[model samples]
Target: MATNITWHPNLTYQERSELINQKGATIWLTGLSASGKSTIACALEQLLLKEKVTAYRLDGDNIRFGLNKDLGFSEKDRVENIRRIAEVSKLFADSCSIAVTSFISPYREDRDKARELHLNSNLKFIEVFVDVPLEVAEKRDPKGLYKKAREGVIKDFTGISAPYEAPIKPEIHIRTDLLSVEESALQIYNYLKEHNVL
Candidate 1:
């Protein structure tokens, strides 16, 4: 069944980029739950829009409500969830739009696979690690997920029952426990500018 698909596109990636007046890229924000990934992503989107950049954000919960609605919190499902998001993000990047993805994609291999996908396509893949202590994240549990996980209402919760392997050398690392949301977003924006991704 897979072999039945054929590759075809009307416009070249470069043409799409030229028309948009900006290059395509994927900015993947990963960390534990309540680690400020979504907040920073939101700010980053606003910042990019102010500069007239075509940026789109694919957040975890929002995507689960739609594209990944059937996926659960099991390890296998989590991997599949990220895989689907990565493919969609690549599509956005191919179209000359910046794709900002915020996910607690807790495993190193999973995150690396996403990066490899973009690299294979010659697209920019920026991995931004939102660093925060587990205690800090629990304290700022805006969605009350940590409390639920602690009560056994949730299973395979990253940083609780599950594991979150920190990135060894991500493109950007923001310590949310030390930095404000605006500061974190600006740091990512600066990275895009310095790397000529903007």
Candidate 2:
């Protein structure tokens, strides 16, 4: 909205990586609610931190309470919520820190847009599909959101009232319904390692 402002350029990405001792990337975890995205993202962050890798997690509900407080669950709001998070994560990656985002970004278009943003900036964008059956996610709903959706207390709920489009070619696919949280986290860590993103 501030069109008067011009872009400012400073250090190059490689220069920032040198200063921070590591390159940065965005680990985008998307799935249906309660598909273990947050749990796996938390574990991944912990694992990376333990290995001396600087990392941060951008959680959906947490961001809603803060940066996206004005947004709601409507389709337009959801799109904006994801767009804002993608921008924030891009900034984090530019700063040479891993940005782990755990959101049920249900639409493929939104997810693709996020990926395009990172790719355009020459930053690594690792799309991680935290996959589980709808029934499994509903059954393991720790926050009872699925229950609320089922009871008609919630609107535009993913995997119920709304749709959840699975990633067609995510860099990493996690079957959380079959894998433990630790395993899922380690799987991603291994991917980052193999891809030289960590």
Candidate 3:
């Protein structure tokens, strides 16, 4: 099945970047649920667009409604879900667009695989650790997921029934518990700018 595939592209990533006037990259935001990953990502997207940058967000829930609709919360399914998102993000990066992904990609191995994918492609992969205490996340419970998990309505939930392996040396670490949405987004935006990804 792989033998018949052929590469066909008229414009290179550099050309695309030249046309867009910005470099392409992937910003992988990982943390426990309600850790403000999505909130910060959305705000960052808006900021990037306001600066005339091409950016797109591949959020966890949004992907589940489409590309990952068939996947579930099982460990195996979760790995595949992140795998697919990482691949898609690479494609977006190859086209010179910023791919912002927000997911509770709890496993270190899984997140490492996504980083490897981007690194091998010569695309910037930023691992952002949206750090928030489990207690705080449960207290916030923006989606009521923590409540459901506590009631046994949901199983294999990260920071509850499942596990979340925090990044050892993330490119950026945002303590959402101590920062506002704008501040968190600005931290990420500053990272992209300092790294020449914007």
- Local distance difference test, per candidate? 0.94, 0.94, 0.92
Instruction: Pull out the clashing pairs in model 3.
Output: none
| Regions of candidate 3 where Cα sits further than 4 Å from its true position | none
lDDT of 1 by residue, 1-198 (tens): 488888876998888878768899999999999999999999999999999999999997679999999999899999999999999999999889999999999989998999999999999999999999999999999999999999999988899999999999999999999999999999999999998997
Per-model TM-score, in order, reads 0.97, 0.98, 0.96
How high is the lDDT of residue 94 in model 3? 87
Candidate that would win on TM-score: 2
- Model 3, CA-based lDDT: 0.92
The window of 10 residues in a row where model 2 has the poorest summed lDDT is 1-10
> How much is 155 displaced in model 3, in angstroms?
0.9
Q: Write the per-residue lDDT of candidate 3 for residues 1-198, one digit (tens) a residue.
A: 599889986987778878867788999999999999999999999999999888999997679999999999999999999999999999988888999999999999999999999999889999999999989998999889999999999999899899889999999999998999999999999988888787
Ranking by TM-score: 2, 1, 3
lDDT of 2 at 59: 96
Identify the runs in model 1 with alpha carbons over 4 angstroms from their true place.
none
Worst 10 residues of 3 by lDDT: 12-21
Cα error of candidate 1 at position 33, Å: 0.5
